[model samples]
Target: MNTYKQIEAEILAASNILITAHKSADGDSVGSSLGLLHFIEKLGKKATICHPDKAPDFLDFLDLSHIITMDQEPEKVNTAFQEADLIFCLDYNSTDRVGKDMTPLLESASCTKIMIDHHLDPQDFASITVSDTSASSTAELIVELIELSENGSLLDEKIGTPLYVGILTDTGSFRFNSVKPRTHEVLAILLAGGVKHYMIHEMLNDTNTASRLRLQGFAMSEKMEILDVNSVAIISLTKGELEKYQYKKGDTDSLANLALSIKGMKVAIVLSERDGIIKISFRSKGKVNPVNALAANHFDGGGHANAAGGMCELSMDETLDKMKALVPEYFPVQ
Candidate 1:
């Protein structure tokens, strides 16, 4: 049986389905999970989305009432996992991506697990793993999954909206190199089917709060450091600074990309102190200058070459110094 068809079959057979995304949920995670949920619904089965945490406020425009979060409703999340006969893990490469809170339960769940992701080095966990690193986002793969299924006609505006948002944000509004001709093709199909592309873009980017803007502004003007010797830009924010700006989730999400916009910068990293750890986000362009090694080797984190994340046990200032010291090794001046 074809894999996508088998996936469809599983959806049809399952009595209760639960969909999950990685912790620190991003656009692709949220968008892909919801898109798959709606697809499952079209098959006459209702699915629950259990995210590890709440999505950033900008994406709150989407109807998320059906989704249960580990952070907000632990027992209900546990119940959803217990009830599900089949599980779909979206937009993450590994089980640990669900974070410490939900990892043990996910690993222990007796149900059949299917993983759909677009990341490097996917773990050998899920019974059905669809990991396509070449795809722009997991949402792209979700569209492909729907198209490959016999139920291709079931896709409608409800499904396309979040999937389109997934593709939009994961590709940095179609700016990243991970995007391919098929991405635009899938998007074309969605757009033809009445997905309002403009609205998704506006809701994701245009809904920033005042605190979010101030936080970003302060990070750029005050905290940003440019290392011309290696074409690296760094922004380090203490928790106090974050609190002062009334920081919320997703507030610092764009800082690395903004830092990388500088003409001379080849790598951009944003580090913020939270929960006694320095959380880092890395963003870069051009395959010649990948940032994943800096994340994986030095900071105990890894993702795509261009976009990755990590955590440091050191103080914010110490982490910043360590990053600066490590820059030349990856993005050498020569």
Candidate 2:
């Protein structure tokens, strides 16, 4: 069994700490970091969150606005990291996903390192690793860590909100296959601590802007392509198209899942251009492991069996050709 006392002892001994999460900063990453930040601050320690990219607008409600884009400036981040007595990596198993740009900070942090994540096949990089794929979200682990450290009673509304958001998003509003009864139990405890569920729901689902809705419509109507006898659905969007639609952030999050609405479709892929790189999001249902497909293609990415992601350096057409060739290996003919 894994223990948290060592981590707790390190935290207690450290005077300064730096918290970080994976790139693209999803709700789970942001929420877990903020949740831990609140707890560490309560213990009278200085904690700073440094992420690889800015979080989506919906997550702005988490009181993390100040820390949202800290990852943009590498030199500033390195200065903080160098001075920290400890570094906590939350919701990510690998340093690569933490942000390609922050590699130096991660390598140079002269502090006790800890990693907390729920992803399968976590890379052994930190001094202490607390990973359980069974957990719904890293926020859940943060809650457990807090309780184990006898800090559960210290949770407040600020911390509760982000923790609830992580649970809500990763479980797909409790609809994903990962939604176990214990997940509900954890959520119940968070709510009892004054977490507002409706606000989180609204922030995640109800706050879409007009441009984002238009972008979704365009992606569904024109960008979506069905291949392999309806087994795969691909949606591609260019940066110019997104800019034309005045896309804010987090607009394309649901594009992959939207293809799942099609009957008999087993896999969905969303390919979008971001700063000259092709970002791919993969989702599968039952027995279809998109991560395997991604890994086989020389793309460094992974996630749950039902959802995975990666990137390719090729253009849209070239990337599609590779995906078309690679996807069929995992989804064979019936």
Best by lDDT: 1
Worst 10-residue lDDT window for candidate 2 reads: 288-297
Task: Please provide, for model 1 over 1-334, each residue's C-alpha lDDT reduced to its tens digit, 9 standing for 90 to 100.
Answer: 9889999999999999999999888889999988898988888897999999999878888787767899999999999998989999999878999999999989999889999998888999999999889999999999999988999988889998999988998888898899888889999989876799888878887888888999999999999989888888899999999999999888999999899999988889999998789999999989888988888899988889999999999887788778888888888876
For candidate 2, write residues 146-190 as lDDT tens digits: 766756788777777888888888876776777778788888878
Alpha-carbon TM-score of each model against the true structure? 0.98, 0.94
Residue pairs with colliding backbones in model 2 are none
What lDDT does model 2 reach?
A: 0.81
lDDT (Cα atoms) of all candidates against the true structure = 0.90, 0.81
Alpha carbon deviation, residue 196, candidate 2 (Å)? 1.1
Candidate 1 lDDT for residue 32: 94
| Clashes (N, CA, C under 3 Å) per candidate | 0, 0
